[model samples]
Target: MTATAIVLLVATALSSLVPVIVRRRLRSTLVVDAVTTAVMVGFAATAAALAADAAPARGVGVVVVACAAMIAAVGGGGYVVRLVLWAGGADTRERARDSATGDGEHVPDAESESGTEAEAGPLRGGRVIGYLERAAVAATLLAGWPEGLAVILAVKSLARYPELRAPHAGEQFIMGTFASVLWATAMAGVGFLITH
Candidate 1:
């Protein structure tokens, strides 16, 4: 248990920083985005293949399941963090815009999305794809699929899209929750099979 907690703490820290590092290192230019997108797709494919082959490994079933669970947890946590950050960021940006414009009235969230680029985020694509990608990756790893992690991260990076003109906080939260739950379910399904 202690070892697992330590491992998770480390993984969470590392996973949380992936987007930041990518953004800082790769810039948001068109060419960079294109290259990063290609790399992400390749990683997803490779990770999926690795995970599929790792399932049913003798003596490693439990380890795989544990790892998958940890991943699911971290992914879920990351989703929440992303949402909070997005909300907070939007507020700050809005305030700044209002102050600059001297428009006393606050700018609607839509104004920002419609006028400027959406902030960078790891969660993208209406939650469904994100859910499937994360869940599949977790299951793949729990099944003793080698290199599943690489592909999972790759798919996540590629599939991630930001909603610039969202209507409400509830909407975003619902999407995130759905994605997290879906992935968690996938991880559970894989665990059941591995244990059996």
Candidate 2:
């Protein structure tokens, strides 16, 4: 492999490890935020540097690698955001437990009003949704379709609108979506820089 490819590979590997470390360490929010920002900036800078000297023959491979790296980066980056929020006293576990019990002051059980047992837990499938969402955002941005982001957001918002009516749902949605989208954007921006 070329030196540029080797460097990119190493950088991507390290970036992928960052979120895992942060999550395990339970670092302060400020620290986690700083680390996450640094990782994204590092990826962008690396991409830009690679682009500057990339040869025509290597373009396709580099683009593929960059896209893969960006996807991994977005996934890890979202975890980093969650770690930060948890560090900042988000109480996600407690919230989950409360939601499951239908006693959460913030998340109302949909069946509770009907005098039935709480059958459903807090919204299921969020993690998969987040992965898909970030992937779509990154892919759209990298494809030179910035306008597609709005559609993605609109669709996500519309789908989550009912849940948003819950007391803390809006706050959670805003924070999670902002972090997920921002991370995806940064990753795709890096890919764009590398490809162009």
Candidate 3:
């Protein structure tokens, strides 16, 4: 049992680390997202399963799992955010627009769609912000300073105040932020379990 536990813990850390190296250049968008998301879920479940290990990680093991925890926070968190957005039907309208615009098919835009000019385009820098956000969240939780999470979140919201006012941006912002923060917290919990 002791050997099994150690092996599992090591495996968990390595599994989490390996997927980060996956080239996200897959041919299909759906396939790329699905694969990454699958790996993310696998890491989470693996970490959770190893929560009851007989011994906490020591030496370099702690570092490895700590890195893995961050991996889970960023990648898994993204997938969760995507799921929440999809469930909320937040982008459905944009996605379902006239597919017939190309080729021989012709479908005119409705009046509402025609006159609509984006005030400043969709929120830019979201991907970069998400990475920084996840890193900050995971680091704070791992450092045993949970209060830093609140500060980080407050800063993010305040910085994006103008963009958040855009249509659907509020929903996207809230759901994405919540998902990342929550995912980071959970993965940090797993990191804490193994590292401490």
Judging by TM-score against the true structure, name the best candidate: 3
Ranking of predictions according to TM-score: 3, 2, 1
The RMSD (Cα, Å) of candidate 3 is 7.1
Per-residue lDDT value at 132 in model 1: 60
Report clashes for each candidate as comma-separated counts: 6, 0, 0
**TM-score-superior candidate, 1 or 2:** 2
Against the correct fold, how does model 2 do in TM-score?
0.63
Clashing residue pairs, backbone N/CA/C < 3 A, model 2: none
Question: What's each prediction's TM-score?
Answer: 0.34, 0.63, 0.71
RMSD of each: 12.9, 7.8, 7.1
Kindly list the per-residue Cα lDDT of model 3 for residues 74-188, writing each as its tens digit: 6566555655565676552223332334342323324335754332224666656877898899999988898998899899989999888778888878877887788778777
Q: Which regions of candidate 3 deviate over 4 angstroms? A: 1-28, 92-121
Candidates' C-alpha lDDT: 0.44, 0.61, 0.63
Maximum-lDDT candidate:
3
Report the lDDT of model 3 for residue 105: 34
Which regions of candidate 2 fall more than 4 Å away from where they truly are? Answer: 1-6, 17-44, 49-58, 87-89, 94-123
Q: Scored by Cα lDDT, where does model 3 land?
A: 0.63
lDDT per residue (tens digit) for residues 166-194 in model 2: 65667667777777888777666555555
